[model samples]
Target: MMANTNGYLVGSNLERVLKAGHFAVTAELGPPQSAEGDVIRKKAGLLRGYCDAVNLTDNQTAIVRLSSIAAGAILVQEGLEPIIQMTCRDRNRLAIQSDLLGAAALGIRNLLCLTGDHQTFGNHPSAKNVFDIDSLQMVQMVTAMRDERTFQCGDSFKGPEPRFFVGAAAAPFADPVDFRPLRLAKKAKAGANFIQTQLVYDIPAFEKFMAKVRALGVHKQTYILAGVGPLKSPAMAKYMKSNVPGILVPDELIERMELAGAPWAGKSKEELTKDDKKARSAAWQAEGIQICIELINKLHQIEGVSGVHIMAIEWEDAVRPIVEGAGLSPRPVVTESPPLAAALG
Candidate 1:
C-alpha cells in the first residue's frame, strides 16, 4: 500500500505527478480478447517508461476483452502503474462498488469512469444493456467510497476503503458542443480528479472549448489530458472524420495523410502489389506518428491542458516515438507513498 506523504487524495503516482506540476503523459493499452497475462506484459513492456501511467481499457468499443481490473493487476506485477477503466454500461452499482474494492485490494490505484459504448455497437448486439448509473454518478459513488468510507447504499465499510485517484472522460466536440463544458463541470463537481478528453484534431475548436473550460473554472479543479491518436491511413482519417462521434479530425490532417502515400498516388489499389501496399502503409503510419507528435506539442502549450493521453490502439510501439518526439520522454519519477498502517506508525 502506498501512503500519501504529500497529502494526496489517493497517493497514486499519477496524483503525485500531476500535483508536482510536471506535464504528465498517459497512454492506453487494450487487453487482448483472450485470457493471456503475457499479452498485457508485452504491451506494458512497450509503454513502461514512455508515460506516467497506462490505462487498461474496459471492453473498449463494447467488444469483450480481458477485464480491465484483471489486466491492471497484471500490470502491477510488471512494475508499471495501471489506471483501470470502469464503465457503467454493463454493471449496476453493486457490481461496480464490488469491483472497485477488488481493484484497490490488488494495488490498482487509479480509475477512469466512463458511460461506456452502447451494446449495439459491440459484437454482442443482442446483449441487454445496463445503465443503472451514468458515468457522472459512478464518479460521485467512488468519491464517497474513498472520502466517506461508505458504500453507495449507505453501508459503512468496517475497515480500509478503496482510496482511488478517480478520473472521467470528456468529449469537447460532442454534440450540443456548447453543453460540453457544463457536463465537464458536473463530473468535476462529482469529484473526478482528472479528465481525459476525446481525441482532438481540430486545434482551433479545442481552443474554443478550453476557453470555455477556463471561464467555468473547471480546469482549476481537475487535471485535463487531451486524447490524441495516430491515424493509420488516409481512409482511417476520413472514417474518423465522417463517422466517429465526438471526434473532430480536421480536413488538413486527412489531406496530410493522403499526401503521405504520394509515391503510390497514381496507382490504383488493384494495380499495386503487396510490396507497394506495404510501403504505402509504412509511409502513412510514419506520417501519422509525426502528426500525433505535433498534436502533443501543441496541446501542451494550451493553458489548461495538463497532459496528453496517447491512444495508439493496437499499435503500442508508436507510443515510444510519440512520447520522445513530443519531448515528454523520461517520464517524471514520483515515489510511491507509504502504506496507511506504516504512515500511522
Candidate 2:
C-alpha cells in the first residue's frame, strides 16, 4: 500500500481527501434488484462529482440485491470510487476471503465489513444464519490479509495480497447506548481504520455518543463519518422510527414533516388527488432535505467527526441538493491513481 506524505495509507481519493484534512462527503448507492449494469452506471454518474466515495451496500436490510462487488466494478468503470460492503449473513469464512481476493483482483481498495441483519427480517427469512465469523473477526481477518499477507489460518499468500482501506459500522442510538462507544473501540482495536455510523437524527444523543467515544480515545484511532439523510415523508419517518432497529427519529422531525404536509390536512383519503398528494409529499421531502443540511452543518463542528455519510437510499437525485446546500459542493480534488486496476497493479 502507498502512503501519502502524511504517512496515511490512502488507496482511493476518498482516503486521500479525508487524510488531507478535508471534510469528506460519502453517499450510498443501492444497486438495483436486477442484473443491470446500466442501472449501476446511472447511479454512479449521479454521485460521481458530488461525493469523495460511494458505498455500495451488500444486500442491505438482508434484501437480495445485485452483488455489491459486481456493482462496484461497474462504478469503477464509470470513473467513480466505490466502498464495497461485505456482510457475514450469506457467506462463510472461505467465501468471504475468496470474495475479498476477487474484489482486490478487480481493483477494489475500500471495504466496509458488516455483521448483516438477521435472515428473519429479510425476504429469505427461512434461510439459515451464517455467523461463521462476526464483523469484528471479519475486520481483523481483512487487516491480516492486507498488512501481513496471510490468511486467517496463518497461511502465507502466494501472490500479492489485497490492500484495502478498511471500515466498519456503528449504531450510536442502539440499546444500551453506553456500550456503543466501547463496541466501536473494540472494532478499532480489531483494525477498523474508519467507521460509518447508522443514521443520526437526534443530535443531542449523537453528541453524547461522541463524548463517550472521545473519552475512550477511539476517535484518535479511527476516522468517523456520521450518517445523515432526507426522509421522503411523514410516513417514511414513522416507518423508519418504528421498524428500523437502532434508528432514532425524533418526534420534532416527524412533527415538522406533518406541518409540511398540513396544506392538504383536511382532505379525505379518497378525496385527495394525486397531484395534491405529490405536492404535499414534495413539501415534506423539502423539509427533510433542510433538516439534513442542518445536521451536516452541525456535524462538521463536532470535534471527532471527520465527515458525513449521506445515505439518500433510493433517492439518488436528492444527494446533490443536500451536498450543495451543506456547502460541500465543488468537492476537493485528490490526485490519486485510478481505483482498482491501477491500485492493484
Candidate 3:
C-alpha cells in the first residue's frame, strides 16, 4: 500500500490526538455502493474544517458499501483525516492482518474493529456467514501487534510490524446492565485502546452506562466517545425503530417528531441541504444536537471520560454549528508526519 499521500497521517492514531481534558469530535459518513465517490468526497471536503477526523463506515448495517480505505484515500488526498472502519464479518485473520499492515504502510492510522452486522441483515440474505473471529479477538490482534510487534497469533514479522490506535464499539443501551460492563471491559482487556459506542438516545441510560464505565475503571483506561445520530424525519425515526439494533428513540423525541408542525413532517427536514434551521423547527434534529452537546459538555468535566464522536449520517455539514454552539473549540495540534511509512513487507 502507498503512504504519505496527504496530511491525514494516520486515521487510527487519534489515540495520540486526544488530550485528557479536552473534548473532541469525530464525524462519520457512509459511502454509497454506486460510483458515487464524489458524494462522499464532497461531504468530507465540507467537514474538513470542522471535525477532528472523519470516519468512513464499512458496509454499514450489512449493506453493500463503497470501500472505506479507497474512499479514505480520497479524503486524505483532500487534506483531511479519515478514520477507517474495519469489520470482521467480511474478512478473516489473514485478510485482516495483511490489511492492517497495508493500511499502516499507507499511513492510515485510525482503525475501528467491528464484528459487523450478520449477513442476514444485509441486502444479500443468502450470503455465507463468517464469524471466524469476533470483535473481542480482533482487539487482541491489534493489541498484540502493538505490544509484541508481531501477528496476534505469534507470527514473527519480516519487517517493522504494524501498530494501530485501535478502537472498538459498544451499545450501552443494547442489553442488560448486568453484562454490558463486562463485555465492554473484555474488549479493553483484549486490547482496544478507544471505545466508540453505538448510537445513544436515552441520556439517562448513557449516564448509567458511564457509571458502569467509571465503576470498572475502564473509563480511565480507554477513551470513550459517545456516538450520536440526528433524527432527520419521522420516516428516519421509523427506519431506526425497525432496522437499527441497540438504539432506542425516546418517546418524547418520537412524539415531538410526529407531533411536529407541517414543515417537519414534510420534505424540508430531509432535503434542506445545510439548513440547520429546518431541522431545529419541530423536529428531533436540534434535540439530538443539544442532547449530544449537553452530554459532551458534561463528559468533558467528568474525571475519566475523554471525548465524543458525532455520527451525522447525511448531516456532516451541520457538525460545526452544533459543536461551536456547544462552545467546544476545534484545536488540531499539528504533528509532522514520520518519513514515508509505506513500504510493502
Candidate 4:
C-alpha cells in the first residue's frame, strides 16, 4: 500500500497496516466536544505525521464528538491513517452496518468496536442507552460483512464488502475477572482480529491475565494491546478511583502521590502564586514505567500477544518518546506511486 499525498498509505487496509509490528502503537485523536472543526483538525494534525495510526473517538466520554467519520475524513485530508471507532450505545444494527459501509467507501477501514459507555455516564444524562448488541456481537457482524460479504439480515453482496481490521476493547482491570477470559475468548471466537485493553496499572494483574490466556493456549491467535497512561494530577487520580469501572487505583499509590505532592494539594492558591511549577511529577516512571516496558518486552517475548497498542489519550503526544524509550523504533513509512490518470477510450 502506498501513501496518499499527505503521506498516509492510501490503500493499506487492516491486515497490512498492523504488520509493521514492534509494539504496534496507536494514539487517539478525540473528536471535538462540539462542532468545532478547527480544534479537531488541530488535534488530528498534531499526531498526524507520527504513530502507526490515529483513532478518531466516537462521542467519547459520551460527549458529542465531531462524528468519527467526519474527523476521519479530515485526518485523511491531513494524511494520517484514521481508525474510525464505532460504538453500540447510540446506534442499532442497521445504523452500525450502514456506517461500516460508509466508512469503507470513504477510505477508512481500521475499526474499533466498542459497546460504549452508558448514557448516564455523560453530561447529557437524559440520553438513552442503546445496547442493541454487545461488543463481541459487533465484531462478529463486521467479520461476516468483511469475510462473507453478507449482513446480519442475510443480504447478499451487490459488489464487494470492505476489508477491515476489526478491533475490540478488553478491560483487564474492569469488574469480575472471570468475565475477562470469557469475553476475550468470545471476542476471538467472534472474529475480533485485535484487542485494545483497558488502562492497566497493576503489572501483576496484567501478567496474570496474559497467563490465563496462555493457559487457555489461544494466546497466539489474537492481537493484545496493553493500555497505559500517566496520572495527570491527584484530582484526576481521585476521579478515576471513584468513578471509573473495572479500574482499581491502589490506595498506596494514591498516598504516595499525595506525599509526593506534599502540601501542594492542601496548599492555598496564594502559596503557589509565586511558584507555578507542578506540585510534583507523578512518578509514573518509577518501576511502573519499567513494568510496562517489561510487559511490552514480554508480550514481544511471548507467542500469543502480537503487540501492544499504547493509549495515552490526550497525552498521546508523548507516545513516540515512550516507544523509543522502550527501545522500539519508528516503523518505516510505505511508499506510493503518484495518482494515475483514468484509462481513455
In candidate 4 the C-alpha lDDT for residue 11 amounts to 39
How many clashes in each candidate?
2, 1, 6, 5
Residue-level lDDT of model 2, residues 276-339, one tens digit each, is 9888888988999999999999999999998999999899989999999999999999674444
Give me the displacement of residue 304 in model 2, in angstroms: 0.3
By TM-score, who's the top model here?
Answer: 1
Candidate 1 residue-wise lDDT at 268: 87
Give all candidates' CA lDDT scores: 0.92, 0.88, 0.71, 0.68
Q: Which ranges in model 2 have alpha carbons more than 4 Å from their true place?
A: 1-10, 336-345
Number of the top lDDT candidate:
1
Residue 40 in candidate 4, Cα distance off native in Å: 2.8
* Residue lDDT tens for model 3, 191-305: 7777888877677777877888789988766778888666666667677876777887777766656665345345554665556554545355665566566656665655555
Candidate 3 regions with alpha-carbon error over 4 angstroms: 1-13, 238-243, 259-292, 298-303, 334-345
Question: What lDDT does model 4 reach?
Answer: 0.68
Whole-model alpha-carbon lDDT for candidate 1: 0.92
In model 2, the worst 10-residue window by lDDT is 336-345
